[model samples]
Target: MENTATRLADIHANIARACKQARRKPEDVTLIAVSKTHEAPAIQPLIDAGQRVFGENRVQEAQGKWPALREAHPDIALHLIGQLQSNKAEEAVALFDAIHSLDRPSLLTALARAMDKAGRQVPCFVQVNIGDEAQKGGCPISELPAFLAEARAAAIPLAGLMCIPPADTEAAPFFAYLAKLAADNGVAGGLSMGMSGDYETAVMLGATHVRVGSALFGVRG
Candidate 1:
């Protein structure tokens, strides 16, 4: 198997190529390695290779993996990128640096209560259902402005916005839309869009952070 250092260099090369194609500075886009379902053994070498930010899809999975990995590598940042249950809000708040799937008021309320109880403020991104897919778990685009207003009223730090484009859609326009929304909201950080498949397009469209899994780690078992 290729060592973590080799894999990281390869991934960085890919990011640089993508940035060149997108006409963006290589530093403008941040790569967030998605470490869901994989264990710490799989991640440690990557940490050693200097990857600090990771995205996890499930709260339970992250809760299990983070403690040990954190003990070993205290600076790693964990982001929650999956749909969050209100019941899991407290643990999620405690474990993740940022939650990227705050889609409803109930979830926000739960996170607020959890933060209050923990006495720690957590940054969060509002997931926008740009594709308007009924099966997806993001808030409707039309409801975003009001949602932001409400979140602001509640003193929740609205870090930025995240979205997943339709599977068949070209990712650039969707990513551009997200960048536009972030600009409109006056929040200049945290556009957590794009994945391994279309991250190059995402970089061109000004993605601040791109979640790359298979491209970095190979296919998950």
Candidate 2:
């Protein structure tokens, strides 16, 4: 518990420092502690440490854990930061407070229908394949404009853009490109880029939300 609290403080301090350097408010940048694969016992300490927002990877994995956690801490905002399958749209709509992996027309359509059925409009960040990696789950750079228009047509509450830069590379350029893409497309929501390693850089580059995992939880064994 002490370690968790200390790490949380350190991360917050770093974020504040980065924000100060970038002339941005720390409050404007949300810190989403990526809690994927971590159990409740491990998570409670962070909650106790006053960390509210968390990001999960898979719908099924999140379903198995988050319900009870949310019951205890209703203010905790759970975000789906992993690739979402079209079939799980309804469950994703019901479980997640925000969706950060919205990448395709079919999934967009599914989520729209789910929102309509549940009378809930969850904010979503359209994931961009910024590095254009074939295995990554994001809309191609060329398709983002049309995709954004399609998402708007479907009425998915736009919460800005998201991306995972190719691994083993400097992430700043990718983050800058994502910021530019959002600006060019008139996306007025928060930018959801950055993870544990480069989150501070992401904040410096105009990231509104940073998804951090191992840094907070320690290396997963």
Candidate 3:
């Protein structure tokens, strides 16, 4: 594994620099080390370096490792940052500390039922298809208002907005737009935009949570 601590420090320093430029506190932004496709041995070093938040892409992948990882470090906050299937709602509710892919009514309903059954409310970041890309797995920009409203009505805790800008394009506008959407809707859950590539930009634009993967964990196999 790459030297996890050094990479984390570099990412944190970059985040600090971005926060400074934006006049925001570095502490205000949560850095979620995306641990999807990485094994527990690889993730442990980051934990040792004081990284408490992690993002996993799949329920099954996370399920395979996190339970054991969490056993050793109970303070770790695991987040679901990938497209979620309704069938896995219950498991996702039980496993993840937060959900960052709540984009559809059916998934929302499934999560609500899961939360009710589990007696735990996992905060969620509604993914917005900001680029209007057909292949993306986010709520279309047009449907966000009603979707957020539906989430609220279902009593799912909203944790701000999340988005992935179209690959290989300037991401600033998308981040800024997401910030505006959050403000317009009175969303106080904090924006969950940003990743390894454009996390600094995301931070400058008011991202409260950034999901970074390769930079910290090295490129996946």
Local accuracy by lDDT, each model: 0.86, 0.95, 0.93
Per-residue C-alpha lDDT of model 2 across residues 74-161, encoded as one tens digit per residue: 9999999999999999999999999999999999999999999999999999999999999899999999999999999888999999
Residues 1-221, candidate 3: write the lDDT tens digits.
44879899999999999999999999999999998888988889999999999999999999999988899999999999999999999999999999999999999999999999999999999999999999999999899989988999999999889999999999999999999999998898689999999999999999999999999988755
Candidate 1's TM-score reads: 0.93
Candidate 1 ranges beyond 4 A from true positions: 20-23
Q: Which has the greatest TM-score?
A: 2
> How much does each candidate deviate from the true structure in C-alpha RMSD?
1.7, 1.1, 1.2
Ranking by TM-score: 2, 3, 1
Report model 2's TM-score to 2 decimal places. 0.98
Over 112-168, each residue of candidate 1 has an lDDT whose tens digit, in order, gives 899999988899999999888999999898888888888888788777899999998
Off by over 4 Å in 2: none
Better of 1 and 2 by TM-score: 2
Residue 4's lDDT in candidate 3? 79
Q: State which candidate, 1 or 2, has the greater lDDT.
A: 2
Cα error, candidate 2, residue 194 (Å): 0.8
Put the candidates in lDDT order, highest first.
2, 3, 1
